[model samples]
Structure formats: structure tokens, C-alpha cells
Target: MWGTTFNRSRSEQTTVPCHECGAQLKIQRSCHEVFMRCESCDRIYDIADYVAEMDDAMERFMEGVYCDRV
Candidate 1:
């Protein structure tokens, strides 16, 4: 995460489109792992399953990964 200084607006967030409810899925990272979570339906998903659907948010999220290495 980018700590408390950075925050993304709804339009800037990643949207994977949940299979069950058709809601947008959010990309989340925890303890060195990244995954997809659907807030609307309360479901967790493997990020690998939707790599191809990644968009701008994915790029920004991954950027944070290497930034945290410092």
C-alpha cells in the first residue's frame, strides 16, 4: 500500500467485473500477496485469473510493489 498519503477515486480503481453479481472487483495486496476482492458480494478471488483484464489501476498497484522495496 501507499500508506495514508495516497488514495484512489472510484473512477481510478481497477474494475474486473465480478462473475456472479457483475460488480467491479478491487485489487488488493496483503503480506506480499495480491488478490481480487468483490466488495459488493464479499468474495475473494485469485488475481492470476484476471491478469489479462488488468488496466491502469493494476499498473499503479504493481508500481507500488517495487516502490515499497526501498
Candidate 2:
């Protein structure tokens, strides 16, 4: 059930630089959200990329921790 409306009342938010406009964009945090739009340039960005990046970082951190414990 995909919808076009987004609730702006959520307090969970983060600021990230827009890829297209280079302006600070407010991103709402949600597990179901797959995409976000920049308010400045109206450019859309895939949220999966950010998630993948965080996953990769966590993997590396865990690997480092395991290596240190060995």
C-alpha cells in the first residue's frame, strides 16, 4: 500500500545534504520509507542507498571488533 502523502508531524528527523541542490534536507525516519524528496530542488533520492551504506559500515565495525577479540 504505497501512498503519496507523508506525515510531517513526526519528530524523528535528520538533515542530509541534497545530491542535486546541495541544500540541507530534512529526512523523516521510518522503516517503511524507501524514498525521500529534497525540499529545495524537488529531487528524489533512494533511501535504500543510505541503508546499504549504514549496513556496510556496521559490517566493517563488527569485523573489526571480532578481529580485536581474537
Cα-based lDDT at residue 31, candidate 1: 57
Tell me the tens digit of each residue's lDDT in model 1 across 1-70.
4655443332234766987788988877765566778889998888777778888887677655534421
Give lDDT: candidate 2, residue 35: 47
Q: Candidate 2 residues 1-70, lDDT tens each? A: 3223433332223445667787754444343443445678977666544443333323332232322221
Candidate 2 segments whose C-alpha is farther than 4 A from its true place: 1-13, 28-32, 51-70
Span of ten consecutive residues with least summed lDDT in model 2? 61-70
Alpha-carbon local distance difference test for all models: 0.68, 0.44
Alpha-carbon deviation at 1 in model 1, angstroms: 16
